[model samples]
Target: METMMLGVYKIPEITINSGIDWLGICGIVLTALIVVLGTWTTIKNFKNTTLSQEAVAEATSNRQFVHIKAENVAKNRQEWINGLRSEISNFISACFDVRSVYLNQSRPTGLVPELFEDFVTVENLERELKSKLIAAQGEARRCLSLIELYINPEEQASIDLVKTAQEIFHRAGDTSFNLTWECDDLVKIAQGILKCEWERVKQMV
Candidate 1:
């Protein structure tokens, strides 16, 4: 009976902590920490994305509008150039609509596909039409200059002819090509008139 009692006392003296129990406690604590941290991170990212997305969209829209307006302005300026020479008596004012079509073509940015593509096309057309128009304007200016110089002091009949040619030059066709043709004729006529005027002036001298 005494030894049995001693054995019972020894059993009670053993540590209450178990290796398995400590491991289980630690695992539970780690699991709870992970859950809390994961939830916080997910919520933060979700909220930030929502707000930032709207701001990004607004910025993109503003840029798109600016680009569109710029394209329109360019179109308007070219049209004005085409129509600038028209007077009250003029009919069928020159309008270079093809210039607008020619204005579209350019490098694209990686924006929404449709808008970006339109901008690119407009730029390319602008470049081509610009070149053609510049040449046409130069030709027309030369025609006008030649008339003013060599055809101004001619006979009254010749003056009327030169003035008619001047009107034709100013009225150069609506199409860029047609305008080019008109300017070519004016150029030829002006050269002929200049030759006559120089000879007549030389004889008078």
Candidate 2:
């Protein structure tokens, strides 16, 4: 018995379970996937919001540009109208001066120096009117076409009168040039027409 008791020892056996809980692992994987999906959705929404803001900004800029362009067009149109009015007024005044000189056989007291100097003879008067008529016609052709749309077509007869008066002046060796009555009539008719046009233009403005 003493010999048998000399070498007695006990050792416990350890076991390891290699099997995994696949369900729990699957749940963890699903949670991670959900987090990734949420992050992607947030990023997409931010990009869409940025694009929408840029579109709105572009639209606003376009509207402003159109508004400014319209304003400039209006301003230019008004300036043209004003210039037409001024030219017409000068032409009318010249007609009146011619009429006054023809009727009184003397310069009017209030006549501008240049007008008085220009109408001293029928030839001078004709030259003055020719220059003025050229300016008036140019303005009418270039600028007043739009304004004429609203005016009476009969107003154009004034231009015809001017042309007729000019022809009379150029009729070589024609003695009617010195006839006060003829010159008076031509100037008067032209004056009336210009006044009518000026009034119409004023109303429009």
Candidate 3:
């Protein structure tokens, strides 16, 4: 053992060495603890940041998907509205054509045996008109079926439109059931349906 002198006081070398060793061990342990704490804090912050970013990305993706789907649906509905309008117009026009042919056939065309050649010509014209009327009726029926398919059966407007259209078709040649009034009603109902759909499309936009 050695003795160290400091200002007339004597300190043992073993005591000095032991104190330095204890201080060094405490310093090392404290440093290791600080490093562990820092690493844990950094890891925890990184995990929180990653989770937040993932949540934001997921929300953005969902909003974009919903917006795109709405646009597609609105576009499709617009096309459907245009198609239904055209079919309804065609159906009404064909019904009117059939009505006109029936009215012409029922009109009085005073003729005698002396005008037999003229009457034969009129008969030929009548046959041509009859053929055209048959074609028109067929076209109207086809359009009616297409319109029914385009409309929702559960809707009152759709039901009324289909019912009026059917009545017009069946009474087109009858000349007694107010086919024109029925057609007008059908047009009104179709207009209502189209207006409602247009409003819905505007909302999506």
TM-score of model number 3: 0.78
Which one wins on lDDT? Answer: 3
Counted clashes in each candidate structure: 13, 0, 0
lDDT by residue for model 1 over 37-138, one digit each (tens)?
999999999999988998999999999888777666666544433332232112112222223323332334344536878778666656676776565555
Ranking the candidates on lDDT from highest down gives 3, 2, 1
Q: Which candidate gets the maximum TM-score versus the true structure? A: 3
Please write out the lDDT profile of model 2 over residues 1-205, one tens digit for every residue. 3555555486777999989999999999999999999999999999999999999999999998887776666666556546545544443444334443344433344445466464465556556656655554444343234333423446556555555444433431233445345545655665666566456545443
Off by over 4 Å in 3: 1-20, 107-120
RMSD per candidate (Å) reads: 28.0, 10.8, 6.7
TM-scores of the candidates are 0.31, 0.48, 0.78
1-205: candidate 3 lDDT, tens digit per residue: 9998768567656544434677889999999999999999999999999999999999999999999999999999999999999999999899989988888888866755368797897788789889989998999999999998999999998999898888888888887878778888889999999999999999997
lDDT of the structure predicted as candidate 3: 0.90
Global lDDT for candidate 2? 0.55
Superior by TM-score: candidate 1 or candidate 2: 2
Clashes of 2: 0
lDDT-better candidate, 1 vs 2: 2
